[model samples]
Target: MGSVGVAELRRSLDGLLTYLEPHWDFVNCHMVNYLTDDHWQHFVPEPLRLELNTAKDLNQAIDTLFWRSNRQSQQFPAFASFLAAGDHLRLENYEKLLTTVEQLEQQLATSTHTQLSIKEFMSAKKCHEVELTAALIDKLVQSKSTPNSTSFIVDAGDGKGYLSSRLALQYGHRVLGIDANTTNTENALSRNRKLQRAWNGLTERAELQSQGIIPARRGKKSNQQDASIIPPSLENYKTTSRFITTELNLSDLLTEHFDQQSNNICLTGLHTCGNLASTCLQVFHAQDNCRILCNVGCCYHLLREHFSQQEFFGNKALMDQQVDCGFPLSCYLQERKVRLGRNARMLAAQSIERTLAAKELPNITLYYRALLELLVCRHAPHLKNELQVGKVKKFDSFPEYVKKCADKLNVPWLATVEEEELLLLLEKHEIDRQYLELFYLLRMSFAPVLESVILLDRLLYLKELGYEHSYLIDLFDAVISPRHYAIVAIKQ
Candidate 1:
């Protein structure tokens, strides 16, 4: 889809609000205000509050932050982290702001009184789990009754192969685990092999019982034994059956396998980053054997939004082709239009843990957010050489980190006007931080709905292609694996 200019996009935003207002109202009536109780207190109800607070002034915030006609002249960052306007915001001011924010983050990270909130994270996981499982079971049932086809379980972007191994051992289905990360691919294969060996022993023992060599226990039934249960110690499969391949290229491996056997294949992925999941979807569409597809994808921007099939993967139907994103990308763009705002409250809590661990001041969070905003504007991905977060080597001080970033971004020093300008920008932006935070929180609250849209799209796609026995089911703990939706499309 062509990029809609800010003015036209604002109109589209209004249309979306008009559509979502009723849904917002429904939430307000049924589920909005449960923050008082400890069980529900994890959700701050900030978004609902924003909906109420901005009911009269929503357009004002939009106009101030995102709706200016001049905004169309400047390019926004393709990645979420780099969505700020670097040139418009002076480099010195940006650097100081980032520096200050980093110091604040360091302080936060090294605080003594910090305690992480598991409830908030757990709630988000719980919400996603419900939606994911529903979609998987729905697809599996629809695809079950068809004849003369094997059920091929294909896990794309299979990190460490936890889910893939479980599916293979417990479900008795042949699985193909694909990943771009070689280490992760190797780990997954290793885990699957371990699980496979453990499964083989169970199979052998079951065979022995079937021959009456071993008596069936009183409490345990034959069906229970028949059900594949992986032993904790995977010593048995070390010398026996192997469940998956080790670190093979997905396109080459799948092309060869599918060419030989085309009737039975189901594609799945969990948290496939950027273009990888998109590639999986394209592969599924192109391969005639890929009868069922269940993918829970994250990292939206990595998806080549405007690319045609030929431009990206040399396939035509996988191109955009007037497909409704199903995702509220326009609405998300509207959300971004608000201001230099982010929902790092969860990160804030995590920062608390880091602070306590590091014994540094808690204010490092401010620096991190500030730098993140600057990075968003700068549109630079992979901060390995410059700014680092989440378990990195020690920096002597906040200034040292700033110097590293400044050196990398090619700026010498901060000017007085830049400092003043950056602080002023922060003050101006902070006025609407409450609203932005609310919007972010609200967006997160709707993650289940968002995932549901993706799941439903795949389900409908399969149904449209005449797969009548598709099913979807809850595969595992959503907290442990947020991408817990399992799609089972079978042809018997």
Candidate 2:
């Protein structure tokens, strides 16, 4: 009916709602298609286009929400440019976008003041075990089939026992935090000592506050002490404990601490790498007394061999003989190119200045390899063999970079024609710098989904093991920390 600018259009559309739309055809066609192509690619299959063509009232509602009256006659393009984004519009993945944006904005705001503070870049949640321990305690308290007071927590692959300390000090729960790193176990003990001192101060302060000796807020007038001096539940208190061992020996360590016949124990982890989470799942299933488990798996590829199902390096096997892998490095690289293309525009504006600041531009291949590394964990392995085994000069241009790569791989010099041929291929793939900015939003949307698959595996494993209340919840910012989802399970 009328023209609406990008600003108004964004205000009207909720991104996440668009994702969760119940009408499969509407979502998969109109919204999903527009996203992949920015409504520009006419090459879209007729079946796909027809899917969006709803003639009923349901179709009308979908069209009004997305196409809108203002966009009624703009002759939307059939193909989108790379990373076709439509602002921060009514996307189905709104909550994640909001959280990541909030954290990033806050971090950016404080950046100028703290040039060297990595903590500013960290998420709002505790990097250590305090938050997780609190969550576990809440779950335990709510369970009708709560285990005996002697029940313990097994922190599998526990690096520095962050959660272990919280469980012991706050909830008064005994915990055994295990890890392969000797230094990590030692540091955990050291940190727990420091945590213990700090906790003592907090307890004393809490007591005073409870007795009306202190104020809850800064400079607030108060007649009585604040209740925060003594948190009603150890829910706020933190614990400290440590146990160190290798992956192969974890099962033995768990068996030593937990009795299979009588003890009611819970196995848990936070960001346990590669096969560590898998090991936890196996241990949970194998141990009868280990009744409740909460695990969040990471490093899907490293769990085991996809086909042969070779046990690369874990005590327990979690994967089937076949690895359910998707998205070869090719798709990830394409998406990344789409992302970097937008960022390159900003760099293009300050190209001279940035080039000067760095004192050298990286070789084109090196830059390409770095971007590709972000998509898939592996890097281009042949480049090093092909290029001169020497330190790369920052001043090298794209051609110079290619020449180095060719020389390192022992290939003959690339003619200008050959170089251009390669560059053209990159452009065709939309791997150029122009697509980076917009693709970040889409990438942000996928972060949670990617992580969900990993976390879901752990929940499913727990469920299959007879722990019915096992659930995966969004406990932290998905964008700010894609690995922020938590796997929480209750003992029945």
Candidate 3:
């Protein structure tokens, strides 16, 4: 209800942990082998399942309880009450524990308005992120007691240099974009070259739009001519390929690239993946010169948990080289030995709002995959959940899906199974399709709550370090960019 302070964050963390303790299995269960794993019997209570099955429109019911209805206002069904009373899984209670995006935004007065145009180069979502982030960085730079014109921004995990280009070109700030991939660095430079050429036209279009005047569409020739009109040199925007870590010194890197020395620095990343976000925070704390941090992290599935026994998703050699884990950055979670398993972390990445808005459901391939698991048990027991049958081409029927999967998995025994048997298997489990869909929706509903825990942990980490100005700003529209909250801090 109030701005999420340390005390409030701690309380919310405790409440969320308590609420989620009982449902870890449901969160962690692999949907690929739902039936084979006996997930329904193990996790879902009979009464709730029965109620869901009996609903006239299960899709509508899922939408109502999961997305459309708020805990306090909505008239809940009998199943909802059953979940709350018997299982201690109350949507209303969970909602109360979460620090809402609105609450986070209210803590800082940010302008949603952007000076840049949504040109054909960037999506509306990306345009929004870059403009907003650049504005915040500008404000942060201005707020510094000893604001230096020589101050530069360090864009970590700066893929394709969207934010970096904007900061350098539009805001007149020196930006150094660092990414792990050399290809990305090259591509970012190429993209920036194009952006620099069309910068004037883009700004003019944005200005016209602000004044309620839509710019006229230009022909291919006109567009080419506009692109040929190169703006002044953007030597300020430099990029490099380096996998960033906490130990990586920003001051030294700045000197290496720009051939200039400046202690005043703002470290930023737009949707920095997994450990890179954590690295940005660590780098910020490690370097005295790094005064500001604005990071939006994504790919929670890739986060290396300190307490988790699960195998790290990325290069294990690289992970082992890391000094710290991605999760439990705060002393509170670390002391408690908190662990959100890889499966749960993957679930946390889901977007319930976007799913509901699109009226989307899990692909039929999900059901097919689950069914494939059944065949794997019968034919190749050793290969059950072991086969890495990734994405398959679209198929018209279950038998076709099986053949394609078998070929991909190199499971000759599975491929040999008769088509009639596959059809019969499909017919027998016809009702299970609905069950799995419902189960998927129910599991996805917990996404935001799980995400809140992760985000709060990062915020709490900053708080633990005695940074008074640290904030978790909900900077973008949830539907457009699910990983919207920016972990911002201005070191005093």
The 0-to-1 C-alpha lDDT of every candidate, in the order given, reads 0.39, 0.41, 0.78
Off by over 4 Å in 3: 1-4, 53-60, 66-78, 81-114, 145-149, 220-230, 312-323
Per residue, candidate 1 scores C-alpha lDDT tens digits across 286-387 of: 666666666665554333432112222233343333233322223344244321111111111122112223333224434334443453343443331233
**Candidates by lDDT, descending order:** 3, 2, 1
Reference-based TM-score of each model: 0.42, 0.48, 0.89
Q: Write the per-residue lDDT of candidate 2 for residues 198-283, one digit (tens) a residue.
A: 56455555566656676244344255645356432333222223332222343444445543323666777776665566556666
> Worst lDDT window (10 residues) for model 1?
340-349
Model 3 — which ten-residue stretch has the worst lDDT?
83-92
Write the candidate numbers in order of decreasing TM-score: 3, 2, 1
lDDT of 1 at 117: 15
lDDT tens digits by residue: candidate 3, 297-347: 998887888888856364666566666689989989999999999889999
- TM-score, prediction 1: 0.42
RMSD of each: 18.5, 15.1, 3.8
> What does candidate 1 score in Cα RMSD to the true structure?
18.5
**Candidate 1 deviant stretches above 4 angstroms:** 1-148, 194-262, 275-285, 307-404, 407-410, 414-492
